[model samples]
Target: MSVSDHAMPIGFLTCPGTHPGSPVRRDDAYEHDLQVDALRPALAALGHELVEIDWRSPVEAFADMPLVLVGTPWDYQDAERAFLDQLDTLEAAGHIVCNSSAVVRWNASKTYLRDLERRGVATIPTDWAQAPDISDILFAMEKFGNDTVVAKRQVGAGAEGQSIHHRAKLDPLWCMEQPAMLQPFLPQIQSDGEYSFLFVEAEFSHALRKRAAPGDYRVQSIYGGMEEPFEPSSADRAAAQAVIDAVPFDAPLYARIDMVRGSDGGLLVMEAELIEPFLYPTQGPRLGVMLATAIDRRLCQ
Candidate 1:
């Protein structure tokens, strides 16, 4: 393929840890490379150059790029305000940001699940707390009538600060130190596994089932989880689609609807990952082309 003289540059916002050759790069940083490798070639074919730029870089560094994808800034949760400010700055400069700042702000907090619930999307039962202590955990457990429960940060990703507690193993002094969400621990996460439905430009691209390692509840790759391609039934697909339909904004450039089966045998929204969810391109080989095509359409518009 011949390189175009006027290939447009598209920025992919990554974190220092996911940047190539960073000393503090994460163990799972390979996922960043995999995502870039999948999209780069396809973008090149469309005369768009995919440039990996660290999200923390000076705002001026992004001036040349007219479009930016909120790629893998996996540590954003640790410095969420700064990360969001950067995206807002980019948008103010007239740059197109995939899953725009508005979407980012809405999805930054897990509380967005409440919005989905109000909009008629089925979500796991959760209790919101400013900072949950043992009492809060006990209350949530009692409300859900489950002996085991999961506690997670309201603003978090990759299950970084997540913990599971059981009545038998409860600790009196333990608490989630930040704003938290408490939910009954679903056995389905271990038995049937979690499902991820990948969408590009609001269209279903692929689906996968993610299973955690033995004795673990998190299905993230860093937690020793594995994924297998899944062909969802029509009902399952519609369930996932309902989440997309409920999103208040126009369809984002990309969305990952993570779900788990409930005790009632229906899927519940785990998260509607709009910010920087790993698209699992390996399982969805068409992801690169699908995204590139979507980007091209956006550019044309």
Candidate 2:
């Protein structure tokens, strides 16, 4: 496809800033992803234009674009209801969201793991409590039967509300009005690392292993985490495929299946990232071309 043949521009969403936003906080460790640089040239090669749009801005800002890819609105968790509402408005207004609004809303919270488990998809044992109290925390401990526990806000990222401690340190007063999910602190996250399978148009494209920084358990850059290319085993691919098969949407534009090996030596879903996950790697030949090709095909259809 030539530039002239590509008649539509892509709106790649980014974190929104405050009105005359404050300067970056000194202690803020957020590493803004630079996928745009790779995406622009790659998209241009496929004859599609790329534009960055603040997801916090009014939907009218980019509603005119043919495709609005939810690139990495990492802050959407801050105002989840409003964010999902915005997606509703965009889809209702005839804008095509790459992963679709339904998928976004469902994937917004970590509770999706429960749904996956019910559907027979292998998922790590997780227990959720709404506006939890002390009793709820205690129950999760007894239920998971683990000495150390990992508790996280239902809708959070970058280890924002993650607390790892012995059952004694858990404060039921922690999450106010917001729900939370609890899991056993899997040692493999530090030893074996988490496997992430990237899929485009529901087709597996690449895979990587994200390892947390030494002495840390959160595998995000903010926590000094690092990732390296990984080759998924046959069983690993099957596990990811099963997660894909559980999606209600026709065919997802993109997906990241994050999982780890449980004590019994089986892949268990750690978390499924269908909304705004950074899809490209820092070192490898980028996946932008594959993404651009997918976008082009969708447009032509």
Candidate 3:
């Protein structure tokens, strides 16, 4: 009924029970969405109140808020449909949302990478296959021309629903019952590290490179992944801009363009995280300020 029930500054939408801290190492890297801590002070300094809104919370709870920032809805992968429904609720209520709900819906799945490629965005070679009757799914390995292939659910985050196989039949029991993406395992991940370029509305905020712990291919904190600040080369920056140009939407309020070295000895888009990504603003407070400024500008709109 009010723009903000009590003049709430901003809503940091996240999943229920997700807190600020590093992820716990499991089979896959669990949620390490602790950037809120870094963001709180910056948002507060900007005369904005930072409130955590669980994605599962009733829309009415944050209904009156002026702007809602989709910062850490990491668990949305587990209940992607429900998450989209919540977005619908916000839009129906007419709340200004960052990374527009339309964009989130489009990016809810990794298939967007293919869409990017269709528009001239360089991306990792991905082979998609439905798991139904996939008796010898390992054929995907041959298609990618790699003895080792990485397999994952089309809509997953961090490293969940991912597996590495060495030409083994996609055992119906071993894989999730859903469409999956298969790509040649890039060995450069261990050496050069996976690259992430962070941006706030077309402006480069910062970049970080992630290296998996020994014996792991997944570069997420829970997988023992290490993070270090990185400076993008002119070529690397251009590659990131190309993906931004190919975004299905006009632009994302905040973007994390992930890339890995391809088998051809060049960088390829690993993902263009739009919905809910770990921005690692905690690496520096300025990153938080950059995000805060972006959110403030959107709210003013």
Superposed model 1: Cα runs more than 4 Å off: 1-6
Q: Each model's TM-score?
A: 0.95, 0.87, 0.86
Candidate 1 colliding pairs: none
Evaluate all candidate structures by whole-model CA lDDT and list the values in order.
0.92, 0.77, 0.76
lDDT of 2 by residue, 99-120 (tens): 8899988888788888888888
Model 2: colliding residue pairs = none
Ordered by TM-score, highest first, the candidates read 1, 2, 3
Q: What is the lDDT of residue 72 in candidate 3?
A: 71
Count of clashes, each model:
0, 0, 1
> Candidate 2 — which residues are off by over 4 angstroms?
1-6, 17-33, 58-60, 167-177, 283-286
Q: What does candidate 3's lDDT look like per residue over 1-301, in tens digits?
A: 1232233468888654464333532332233345767677777776778887767778779856778888776677777788888887887798877778899988878888889999998888788877623333467666767778777888777678788776554455565588888777888998789999888787777788999999888888877889988888888888888888789776788898999876666679999988877777755456777877767666666
- Give the best candidate by TM-score: 1
